[model samples]
Target: MATSSGAPAARTFFGHPWGLATLFFTEMWERFSFYGLRAILVLFLIAPPADSGLGMAEGTAKALLGVYMAMVYFVALPGGWIADRVLGARRAVLAGGVVIMLGHLSMAIPGGAGFVYLGLLLIIVGTGLLKPNISTMVGKLYQGQPDARRDSAFSIFYMGINIGSLAPFVVGYLGEEINWHLGFGAAAVGMALGLVQYLLGARHLAGVGDRPGDPLTPAERGRVLRIAGTVAAVAAAVLLIFAALGRLTVDGVTVALTVLAIVVPAAYFAFMFRSPEVSAEERVRLRAYVWLFLAAALFWMIFDQAAGPLNIFAQRSVDLNVFGWQMPASWTQNINPILIICFAAVFAWLWVRLGDRVSTPQKFAFALVMCGLSFVVMSVASNAAAGGARVSLLWLIAVYLLQTLGELSLSPVGLSVTTRLAPRAYASQMMGVWFLATAAGDAVGGQVARLQEPWGDVRYFLLLGACTMAGGVVMFLFTRSLRRLMGEERRAVPSAV
Candidate 1:
């Protein structure tokens, strides 16, 4: 590793290191591919087979979407470890990009449902490798810079994320209005572009993400490689057997993934809490994180459904007319990203301006409340649909705007807090635990979305909205207790988003 003094000091983009720009664009294009797929996935899954879809039931499609999203995050645990102990972040990212491109190409091929399944699996694995390591590299870029600059760099990086997120509109339109394969091909092109730029800008990365954080000894390396190879072979064989038996149904996979999502996080918590390596103070912080984790899960359960029930609602109920042009339903998914790009700076400014007036727990409470209000807005729209009226697209936009505000309050802060509270020996593990919250949420969210078809839209939206509001109220009441558990060290945690 290069020492701070030995590192290049020249400012390149917006007073940050040149590497920030590299990571920024790389992440931007990656997210473009990711969100573009997300915007069209459920639509493609549920559309008629004659229309280039699988013709899966809405409930089944939502369940699969949820499972797929959960697996994408869940795999990051091993993915991060792989980067730390085997492949360096740079190589992992390159390999992951190649896999993602291949995934998109597979989806673009005109074939049966098998192609979709194969594409999703590849994308999930590729995302697992790319997502966490890229964020780690961004942090590495500001390693020796002033502490304040780290937050700014992350803010810039997030803008890149939203910039990439904007692609869903174009890609979704192509997928929904034109041909699904074209949209998938566009996503492949996006990843290709990102990979090309990453290669070109490799020099800017310098000492960042170039080597494993924890290199293994020769003996340890041999043991790990042997174990990993064995595990991979066993997994492949088991999957093949399952597929051959015709037992690999979507529902079966969803149920299995949901169980893993719950069990893995529970096991992680137990291990961390019981470990002698964790000090008493660290244990208290971990307990606080449990509450934070649950809060995040609830928030995501509602937010992530944008691609499931909410996407369906937009297509079925909302009149997407803007200036005499009918828009594709997937275009509605773009609202949240646009809001994030527009207001991320404002939220950052608000946090700084509020200073000591706000606490982490308070911010979380606010997020939950905002999320509940978003659902409440949706409930109203649902009621309008029940009354046989097509609501304005503004209703869905309002819901997305409110949810984006909640995301700004919570998501980045959650990441910062997870890092701050992590034990030195288990930093990456703690980050994985944080991601598990998202996995759990998506898994549960999928199951919840399944109820939408049977329960009717009005009742379903109202029920979810009421439950989320109650959760926010409970979190608000527990805020002081959570703050106490965080102790004085909570003051050091920086707000992000």
Candidate 2:
């Protein structure tokens, strides 16, 4: 096992065994913690209050689901900032794991809206710190060979996500079937297990995520503290204002997220345009990245539905009848991870075989199409259920299988592309920006899902299908230009688009 030092050895995993294994489990547990909570979150929201759940109205629940999910992704911006400028990836992951443990533990508490929201806030912050930074550790694992084990590593890594996701759905079924708190408590336990493994494995992961700053100068230290304080204050003010204005309510959350969808990107753009640090080429790339953001957001609008609208679709419309038995609706959440574990290898092979023939922009175009097509499956299912009969559960499963394949092509690959194309200094922030794009997608999905209540399910699914398809079309139109904008820049550049 070749250990990671100041620079990684230009060697294969066969040449550096421990490095790969270390990255694998660290990422796995993180995903386990993350996806487990996601499995039952919406169901928890929509579960009847008498059942010891949130008992939110369906449409409102969908919106809040979107808001909460969006806010979760929104944290990546600051998480990336703290990692790059302060804590470094390793410490960030450690801190994030602790926070996640606390968050999950909080959820284990019974009763009260305040506790529930506080737990969620903590989880969001923890995920922000964990998600992007953990991936950074994997990158650090193989310093010189960016492409060597990249796809395989992500494939293995995302499998962890699926495993985590699947465990939760199973736990949710048992817990909700037995006791609600049981499921929440089970999720907390998963985080604890992950944290223990991480701590035990710390020595093997030496030198991976330390911050670049040696002893910080007084001015630099002061600047960082001030900026962090300001950002925190701004975040607090926004939350309070939303609370005061009723934006945190089920009715207001969707609107609040929509506003944030506009605000965060606009703010980032303003920063980009004003920053004297960026060169003309970097500015142009940022514009390209913006377009990429819009395109990817459309993709997520459809893809993220797996948790919110899609889960509901399964609950309300999909039949689980098999051998005279019925399955819980939340169980459908397991499909993506299952399929991801199965198909990740196949997609990785395809990407390897295709190599640079299909450009990143082109791959993104395909992702948008697949997302639209998944929605088309849901539309068909929705139509099938129009006569008040449940569509076959197979429909939901098939759609998720397809969506997972699409995600394999786009989501993880998109992260790789961002790290490759973005300037070095902004790598973490660019990753955050990528997540911000997803935040928009999630918010859009929520708003679009709300249309189901008024427009009917068929129209709702159809709308998502149409928008995603249009995004795919637009991406195709700009494929050449986007590739040009990405340039031939290496991943080591200091700032990202």
Best model per lDDT: 1
TM-score per model over all chains: 0.93, 0.87
Q: Give the per-residue lDDT of model 1 (tens digit) for 1-497.
A: 35488985575888787888988998999999999999999999999989988899999999999989999999999889889888889998888999999999999998888898899999999998999999889988878788789978888898899899988787898999999999999999999999999999999898788889898889998998899899999878977887898867888778878988999999989998889999998899889989999999998988899989899889888998889998999989899988888888898889879875688887888898888888888888898887667789889989998999999999988988998888766877888889999999999999889898888887787788778878888888987788888884356455555
List where candidate 2 sits over 4 angstroms from the true fold.
1-16, 19-23, 144-155, 210-216, 227-250, 484-497
**RMSD list, candidates in order:** 4.0, 5.4
TM-score of the candidate numbered 1?
0.93
- Pull out the clashing pairs in model 2: 423-493, 423-495, 423-496, 424-493, 424-494, 424-495, 425-494, 425-495, 426-495
Candidate 2 lDDT over 1-497, as tens digits, reads: 34567675544444454556555666666666666677677888888878878788888877777777888888888787678777888888888888887887787787667777788888888988987788778767666766757655665666666666677555657555766667767777777777777777666765778663344568989987898799999989988998897666657756866788869877987787668877787777777777777778888878887888888777777877779977777778788878877887788788767766677777888888888888888888888888778888789877887788678878877777777656545655677778888888888778778787898877878777877878888888888788778773242223323
Name model 1 segments beyond 4 Å from true. 1-11, 229-246, 489-497
